[model samples]
Target: ARNGFVVNGALLLDHDEDKLANVLPRPNAVTNRPWAVLGVLNGDYPRLHICDRTVTFGRSPDCVVQLDDVHISHKHCTIERDGNNGSALVVNHSSNGTYVNSRRIEGTATLSEGDDVVLLFDRIDGAMHGKALLGQQRVVDGRGYPVLVGYRVISVNLLA
Candidate 1:
């Protein structure tokens, strides 16, 4: 099916070392100030939510953004906005991996608006993406899911 092919195609990029994200530079955290707002979107939870001091994202019920799916890990990653400055760093704790803008991050990356954040990309498994899909025509036919297991950074610091 198209969804399977789309998901599998994204997996292929992970095999190439050179294609992955380079070592992340140490985050220049400025203060304990939390980000004013940040949005995390996916198929199920398409509505954006605001951020707090730090958010642990994974399958665990304790995680602020709990993604209870097969592809997600218990403690997959954490996106922290610890400084007054406008910077949010995502630290990967899952062996399965995390990708920002389609490039796998071995450590962390400061999120930017409009970045595609895919979690556990290898296991999308054709699950329906709900409202986070594209292609009006394709959607009506049951193939409207995104190309990966992910969320969209819809906003950062309240910026669209």
Candidate 2:
């Protein structure tokens, strides 16, 4: 008996690739372990990698990704690897707040590849400030703040 299948007239043998075919992993998602890339607004800052299961980003010196921004709280947010499937959980733990794709994160949020992860901060005037994704400039009030937006930090081709 043949232990294989065919799709679109292509033969798929029961090899290493076939064994893992059923499992659909995101193109850029981590396969064995969960990982993340933290890039500051624009290309001013270097791209930081999150290899550990747990990572903390805040103004505190002890934080894994420390920021000197006054708007950032000492203990801002944490990114935890949810499972071996490469999905991560981002938990907000600061007054400044956290946002994912322009929406405020109530408590925790699941992070995927290419998701827009925004870190918010409250200005003295009560206005909000935060780092957005690259390219997509955010419109703050009347004036169009050509701030950096979108995830153009890392090249997508490398992941594929």
Candidate 3:
């Protein structure tokens, strides 16, 4: 099975593949893991990978970012725990503008359901999903298993 997940419409994958037939998440009657919201940039295989608690974006092999575990390239973005709200992932806009719901989000913003998050990297747009937001993207090399990113909305129950 592939090791990865989706968040805010961004399809996070584990490997670099042009075409993956088993990228989407499979339906589980038991565990009932929350579904991730995903968005894709323009390309045959445009997906991010979540491995070892880090998120690797794009296929260039150099586009990688650390989410909650180890720090990779600080040039991308920062996902930190909200001091005021323990249930939200506070996305800080770096040199590249971090967009939420197609709007450029400055400073720190709380993410809710249905929110679209686009990490500004040229022309690529990364969308967000929750009960409040719902976006979809094709995931590659997912092994038909859900890629679970710990960054989840605290206010909304995505599974419910």
Question: What TM-score does candidate 3 get on C-alpha atoms?
Answer: 0.36
lDDT of 3 by residue, 72-104 (tens): 124444433233433335354355455554555
Q: Which residue ranges in model 3 land beyond 4 Å of their true spot? A: 1-73, 121-160
Weakest lDDT window of 10 consecutive positions for candidate 2: 149-158
lDDT of 1 by residue, 1-160 (tens): 1222111112112223222112112233333332434323323322333335466767776565556467679889887763667576778989878877657799889887677667744323555353533433222111333443456665576421
lDDT of each candidate versus the true structure? 0.51, 0.49, 0.35
lDDT of 3 at 52: 20
120 Cα displacement, candidate 1 (Å):
3.0
Estimate candidate 3's alpha-carbon lDDT, on a 0 to 1 scale.
Answer: 0.35
List, residue by residue over 20-69, the lDDT tens digit for candidate 2.
33332234344443256654433333344444666666667566555556
Steric overlap count per candidate: 1, 5, 17
